[model samples]
Each structure stands twice: as C-alpha cells, then as structure tokens.
Target: MIFRSLADIEALERTPCEQAIAARTTYGLIERAARLHGARDAFVYLPDGELDTAPQRITYAELLANVNRAANLFRSLGVGPDDSVAILAPNIPSTQYALWGAQVAGRACPINFMLQPEHVAGLLDAANAKVVVAFGEHAQLDVAGAVRRIPGIEQRQVLWVSAPGAPTPALSQRANEAVFEQALAAQPDSLQFDPRLSPERIASLFHTGGTTGAPKLVQHTHGNEAHTSWFAHMFYGFDENTVEINGFPLFHVAGAFVYGLAMLAIGATQVLPTVLGMRDAAFLRNYWKFCEREKVGALACVPTILAGLCNQPVDADIASVKVAYTGGSPLPTELADRFEKATGIPVRNILGMTECSGLVSIEPLHAPRVPGSAGLRMPYSEVKIREDGVVALRGPHVSPGYTDAARNAGMFEDGWLVSGDLGRIDAQGYLHVTGRAKDVIIRGSHNIDPQLVEDAFLAHPGVAMCAVVAEPDAHSGEVAMAFVTLKPGASIAGDALLAEVAPRVYERPAIPRRVVVIDTLPVTAIGKVYKPALRLRAIEIKLQELFASQADGREIVVTAKERGSAAVADVRIAGAEDPALAARLQAALGAIAVPVAFSFS
Candidate 1:
C-alpha cells in the first residue's frame, strides 16, 4: 500500500523541477558542495595508532580537486562512460576519491576488501572492470593476490594508491603500474561536466550476497545514488556545522552511499574513527571522549557495536552527540533502552540492503524515536509487505539490476525487489524487521524460525546474546543449534541452557538440540551474527561428539549436505579398519533420526 504522505513532512522543501536539476550527475554533488561549503571541513580521519595528533582534515574544495584529478587519471587510462573501475580498499580517505572520481570517469565497483581472493576475483570479473585501483601494502589488503585470482587480468592495469606510510604494492613495479598520486600529477585538477551525460548512467556497482549462493553485483546509477544521498542529507538536516563520525567501511554500500557520499552531499565533516572501524574496541572505548573533543554531532553504527557500547561506562558528558543511528540488524529493544539510558542520543533503528542505494527506512531526525522499529520509509521509496511478511522495496534508489544476468532472474518479482528480509509494518507505519527469510531452520515438516528462537534466549537471565542456525542432520532435515554468549559474571554452563530454554519451545523439533556457550558469537563486519560459521561449527560439534574419544590416532570429519527438504550426512573416520566402529557411529546417528554414510580412510 502507498504510505499516506499527507501527514509526512520533509524537512527540506524541494520543488519537483529543483530536485530533477540537482540530481543530474555525480559531479553535480561535488560541484554543489564546493560552491556552498568550499572552506568547510569535508572529512576528518582520526588515526587509531596515535590519538594525540590533530585529526586529518580535508576541505570541500580540496576534496573536489582530488576527485577531479582522479577522474582525469581514469580518463587518461581510457576509462569512459559505463566502463567499470574496481577498487579494493578500506575506509581510508582516498577510497572516497576512488568512489566518486571513478564514477565520474566510468562506473565504480567497490569490493569488500575483506572478502576471500576468489570471491573478490569473481566480483571483478562480473563487474567487467578494465582497471583496478588498489590500496598499498599497509592497509593489509592482498591486492596483488586478489588480482592474481582473475586470469588474464594484466597487472599493468592496476593503479596502486599508497597511503601516507604505506609501501608500494609488491607487484606494482614489476607490472609497470602507475602510483595513484603520481598518476594524477600530470592530469589537470578541473574536469568539465559532460552536458550529454545523463544522470541515470550507472555510477557504481556494489557486491551483495552469497546469501543464497554466489554474490551478485548490484547496479546503482548517478540518479539512484544522488536521490539516496540527498534524501539522507536533507532528512538529517546536515550542514557545514554537522560533524558526523563514520566507521563503516567505505567499500560497503551503507558506508559509501549513506555515511560517506551523504556527507559530501551536505558538505558535512565526517570523522573516520579508525581503520578497524566497525565494532573496534579501541574506537568504542574512546567514543565519548572523541565526541566531546571533536564536537561530533551525529554518528551511525550497527546494533552489535551499540550493544557493546551500552556495556561500557559512560563517564563523559556527550552533549555534543545529536543522534546515533543503527542498522545492519534488528536493534534489540533491551539494547536500545540501555543505550538511550546511558547516552542521551537516540539510537534510531534502520534497515537497508546493498541493492537499494543502501537505505530503505530510517528514524527521521524530526520525529520521535520509534522503539524497536526500523522507522518510516524514505519519501522516494515505495515499500510493501508481501503476503508472507517479506519486505519489498521499489523506488528511484532501487538498483536497475545485477551485473550477472543469470543471478538477476526472480530477484525482483512484480516490480518489487524481494528484500529477502522478513518484516512487518505496524499500525503507526513503523517497520519492524523480524529476520532473514532464508535463515529458517527446516526440521522435518516444521519451520524453525531463528529470530523467534533467539529472541526467547535473549530474555533468559544468563544469556547476553544468541544466534540460531540450522545444522545439517542425517534425518529430519536440519535442526536448530544455538551459539550464545552469556552475561558477564552471572554465568552457567552451556549444556544447562538447553534445559532452561527448552520449555519456551513446546514443539519437539523446534527446540534447539544443542546450545554451545561461547565467549562471543562470531559476527560479520557489519555486526550481524555470522550464521555460516555456526552451521559449520554445528557439523564439527556433531562429529566431535561421535569421534573425539573413538578416534585418537587419526582425524575424523563429518559433513552435512541438503537433500531437498531433508539432509544427508557424510561421515569420514580416518583408518576405519574396524567395521564395528562405523556401525556404532551409524547407530548413534540413527538414534537421533539421522541417515549417515561412512567412508574409511
């Protein structure tokens, strides 16, 4: 249903004609910002190694100049309209220049600098990049290694961008690649905006998944990014005085579009907290101090960092912080309450994906903070809750499609993108994200919802945090296995939690078969629980239980594979000369309703 816009008010008034004119091109943003706030601080980066020194500052004029030079460099390299330039870098300042400049020259493809070489290589191949801009050795990125993953990708095409202290990439000289700074030296600092260039031209490509399978490259145009950045900039009431602290990796969609580019849109100062930006302990510890010292007005963080921050003692008066926005996962009501109580800034829950220019909905600055909700939809976006409670998005900010056409099929149905996230809209119009629809655990005929299971455990006195995922089984499909972190000091053993939490789920198969207590649950860079690791651990735990005592001389590994709605297990016990041992293992697995096949080494 169309959200009633009659009562919905926009903080910044924009006539239809004016909105159309402003979003003409990616260069229009930099041009506008330079004109409006040239002398204002555009980006401020705080180094993690040494906090005693003044934070690095870049004025809007300087940022624009750098962007123009970068665009010129790309042009010199023969990159033109619609061509893709792949950048493998972290959250550093040059990453921004690479982002906008490459887009101005061609299309910018930002890789998750943390992804495996093979995955990154696959993405590079999909994006069809003609050139690679890689950060130097100090960023800890294996730039050459990743490039090596792609066959026939000549090293000469790579432009190694070195940081202040970073050494030249090991392979740069041998391949005759130009240094980024030196490459721009001969290029002119000013670039003329192409009058013929349409704003709808593809500006960037961001990688999204491996959620269902291999990651797909989502296409974002100039207009798509412009609309999203402008929406957030105007919505937040950002200006020359607004100093926002951003720790999200610039390679991520949320990081580049919402946190990074949005700042440039308004000419607001962005504080890059650290290289180890997200959920970094050192940064979180000094958050309040940095806020008070730097006059940081706004900041964005994931729910996991917020949870950890809530646990820290708030000793400083952080009156300078105007707001704190959270996304990337559901913000637990309890966590939100604790954070607000400790720090006066409201933690507005938001939900977004890589496909939609990185924002679906956020709690507007003008409105009262809605607890436990992802807040209202952006004015440009049309959101519909599907019959099955799955959230769907369609708007100007929505991506045109993926780079890989094979992966594009069924991605969008009936004009609305299946967000893959399950959620609902309340009567008041606030959206509540439940969980990922694919993360459901299938046990026999019953669907074991992970969010439902995890939420129940979150209420337990001993549990600090919890994640539920399906572990492959020999029989009855997949069963729920919970990995939990207990509250500090008030603890009980992991096995005891099974008995305590079992009563919450009356259905036999729904109850988690195992509760593995952990010092901390594995989390993604964005702070959501990493379920894939837990699934692997589940298989490992089952294998260990069967063979830890039985096989002391050799290694035994068990794997779970899906077979339609049910699953089958492959058990390999090394040097299984004894047929009776296989029988014992099979019988044990069978007792748990599992069908397992054993192979001897």
Candidate 2:
C-alpha cells in the first residue's frame, strides 16, 4: 500500500485542457486526479480517536462524491463564490470537505482553534465568515467568545461535528444551530459540483501567526491553490500509492495546503490519527505501530515530533519510509543526524511560512545537507535573504497579501514576500535560519541575537532544546536568559552549561544571565517553539519570583507617591526593560543576579 521514495511515485499523464473550456479558469486538479485514480484509496483515518484498529479507507471516487456533497450542503446553506466559510479543526477526513467545499463554493478560511478568543474573533471578522464548520466542544468554546465580539456574525449557524461520547456543550444548543450530521442528511450523497471560479479570484485565506499584532490572513487565489499543490506534487515526488501520513494540524498551511491537498492532488492515500497532537509518547507509540502495520511510506513531521521519535526506543516498520521532511521549525542538526542513524532514512529540513502556503524551500533528496540549513529552494520558486537577514520569496504559489493593509504592506516588499525570519544562504544555496527577527534580544548596547545564543547552546551535546529571550535586569536594560531542555541521561548544571557556551560566543558579557532547566519548550502546530510564549512565561517568573524574592524585597516597598510608579515599573520590568542597561552597567541582572543597588531612591 505504501510507495516509498520518489522512484515509487507514479506520475499521472496530464490531461489536455478541453478546447471549449481551454481559456476558462479550471482549477480541476483534484477532480482530474480523482477521475484518473477512481478506485485507488485517496484518504484513510481511524474510525475512532483512541483505537489501534485498521484505518478506514476511501477511494478517490468516494472522495469526489463527498466533496460534491460538501459543496451541495454549503450551497444549500446559501454558501457561494466570494462568500467565506470558516473551518476550525485538526487534521481529519472532514477537514478536506471544508477546504474543498470552499474551493467549490468560494473562499475558505482555516482558523487555528489553538488561538485565544480575541485572536479567533479577529480572524472571523476579517474573513467575514457566514458559516462555521467545527468540532462540537472545542468549536463551541472557541467560537462563543469570538462570536460575542462580532455581533453581526450569527453564532446559531455553527455546524457541530458530532464526536462519539462527547456531548454538545450547553452553550451550543440553539434552535437556529445545525449539527454536521443534520447538514449531511439534507445533502445528496452524490452530486456534481461545478462552481464558476476565476484563477485570480480569492479561493482561500490562510491566517499566519503575526509577530507584533494579531494573525494576518494570506489570500490564495484558485490558481495559487492549484499551483501550490502541483509544486508540492513535484517537490515531494508523490506517486499513486504513497502512504502519506497526515499528522500536522489541518488549520495551518503545512497541513491544509501542502501535505493534505497535495496528497489528494497526486492520488495518494493519506493516513491520519483520530486526534491532533500525536507527538506524545502513547500517541506516537500507537502512530508508529500503525505505520508499521500499514507500511506508511512518507511522513511530513515537525522537528518536535522528530525529536520525540528519536528520544524513544522504537522499532516500527519505518522501513517503508524513504523521505521524512520536517518543517515549521528548524530541525536540530543533532536530532536530524540521530533520526537518520536510527531509521536509516534521510530527514530533510523544510522552511516556509504560512504566507508562502508552506514548502517554499526544502532539502532535496540525496543532497549534501548543511548542519542547520533547510535545503535549497523548491522548483518554480526563488528564495533570497535580505540585508537585514529576512527570508524573501516570490513564486506562482505565493499568496498575494493579507486582508489588513498594514499587515500586507509589512509582509511584502516590491512583490517579494518578506518573511520576517533571519537566515543565511550558504555557497551551496542551502538556507540556515539564524533566528526570528522578532525574537532578537538587545542587551545594553550590544544586540544579543537569540539565534546566536541558541546556536551556542545547540553546539553543546547535553542540551537537547533551547530558547533564548531577553529578561529584564536593573543593571543591563535586558539580559539573555536561556530556557533549556537537556538530553536523556545528560545532567549539567547552570554554570557548566554556561561554560560550554561561553568560549564560542563573542559576547562574553552577553552570555545568558541565567539558564533555567525546563522539562520541555512550548511549540506551535508546525514544531516551531513558541518563543514569545516562553518569553512571556520567563518575564512572569522574573517579576513574581525572580525579582520578588530579592534581598531588598522590603526595600522595593514604595512610598504612597511611588506606589503607582513602582507598580508600573514592576509590570514593565516583568515584560521588558530598556536595552541600554547592559552597557550602562557592567553586570547584567538575571533571575539570580540581583542588583546590589536595589533602591530607586
């Protein structure tokens, strides 16, 4: 069932465009694939969330029919071209319907359910969604807060995906509301869906995580969507029988646009776990076992998942795996080496943002990989690093811009999508991402780039994972603080870990003021560590515990006049400090290094 490697990938003969409609816009890539591979399995998923039983498979014919049904159901609900429908769920068979239905109807906005309520509301309002398709409990909880903010959007029309044994929340019970099953019942099981679409028309809005403000929505045209899938088909070199594993969240571009849709475009069968976040021990164990049983061919996993897979002692039927592409985060050199050593499969790192619809660049097969590079640009794509260390890309598959003008303006420069990620392009053209532009830490007069600090820690054998952020110090405006997750059987204290990194780094004084030992770092759906979240958490520690537990704890007590000022200062210090302090004061303030002069008086 699993076709391993690009050699095993079957290439479908391109069907000549019908002369009558040759000039018309036809994003019929999926439809053509379905027709060519009618009897072949197109998608597979477990019937239940927690089960080891064989996956239930659906052929391309059934997939086409289901997509048609989904289109019909959306049309029945008054959905049409230009109207936006929102889907908030994990990687599942149903996600395909929501997405493809969008293409058949109008534009679909795949909103990340993991976002906070206000963030969710912002996207819903931006997309101007009419119908929302989501899981029962999670959707109700997420949308309830979002719908409250946007009074114009009705909360009653939500279609709850009824999960077994899970009750619809009391908040979701309403007369105008409709469940997914009810909607499907009204939809014809088989119907031909032929919606008029233009190649340049907006087909999907992919929301990406923002650095400064709320998430920005990336507009993908019908042509761009198909082009992206075609590019992925060529990049992955998918064949007819590729056992594609669908584990990343479908809400994101990597899951929804790249792997999920690309697999369908190539007539490949996709296997997905019943639930999201399968990187945990128990879930991964079950996943690998299933892969062995099903003989999965390829997996597009995140760096975090790959690390977990390497951490554990597993011997599954990974023999079918030919290429394992890890993206959404920089795959650690050590982890990639370990994975290749263990499974004897190349784990190529991929780098792209949601703006590019994912897979803008990737390490090609049999190519000599640089230690930390994410490989060369994919076919039909051009990648370049700007003078400011930003990754910029331009290609047919690239999205135009987001809904917000300000965001769009910042995202693109002279038509090139300027990814705010900092990276270096080597002589061989492999890209080595140094760090995120936003994650940079300014220490005193020196710019203590987090990527530089992280790379220093990465060189150490004991350090498994690390994130560097600016922590407030009274002396230095801000000092670098490193949160580290150690490797198994590796024990190194703060001083020892600091010593390992001290020699290699140029900023001797800019060395991490303190290294906090953490069990694990927070990661987004794509495996990129959520450094902002970690930085926020670290700031809280510095405020309530690190700064609060100072010897002058009482000395920090303010007069009635200074009370308000002190409270504001405390809050400011908790989050960030003036970047001028490090140079002003020779010694930096850290979680442990309390300033000797503790009084503002």
Candidate 2 per-residue lDDT, tens place, 1-601, comes to: 1212222222211333232121222237667777899999887776443444556677888777777777788877777786788887666666677678766777788877666656776777788777887765553234444443444445525776653334653444465567665576667756546686777788888887633245668888876666656556555656788887777777787777667777777778887766554643455666666677767888878876776666756566667877887888767676778778766777877787777667667665555556787766654457888888888888766777877777777778788998777888887667788777767776667777776677778778787788888776666667889999888999989777887788876578668888888889987766768776676666555654433444233323311112211212232222224434322322333433322322233
lDDT of 1 at 30: 76
lDDT agreement with native, every candidate: 0.74, 0.67
* Candidate 2 Cα deviation (angstroms), residue 527: 3.4
**Candidate 1: where is the Cα deviation over 4 Å?**
1-6, 9-21, 139-153, 165-172, 192-196, 210-213, 234-237, 279-281, 442-448, 460-462, 471-479, 487-490, 498-511, 543-555, 559-570, 577-598
What residue pairs clash in candidate 1, if any at all? Answer: 474-595, 475-594
- What are the models' TM-scores? 0.88, 0.82
Alpha carbon RMSD to native, model 2? 6.7
Q: List where candidate 2 sits over 4 angstroms from the true fold.
A: 1-27, 47-51, 137-156, 163-173, 189-193, 210-213, 279-281, 444-449, 459-461, 473-478, 488-491, 504-510, 541-601
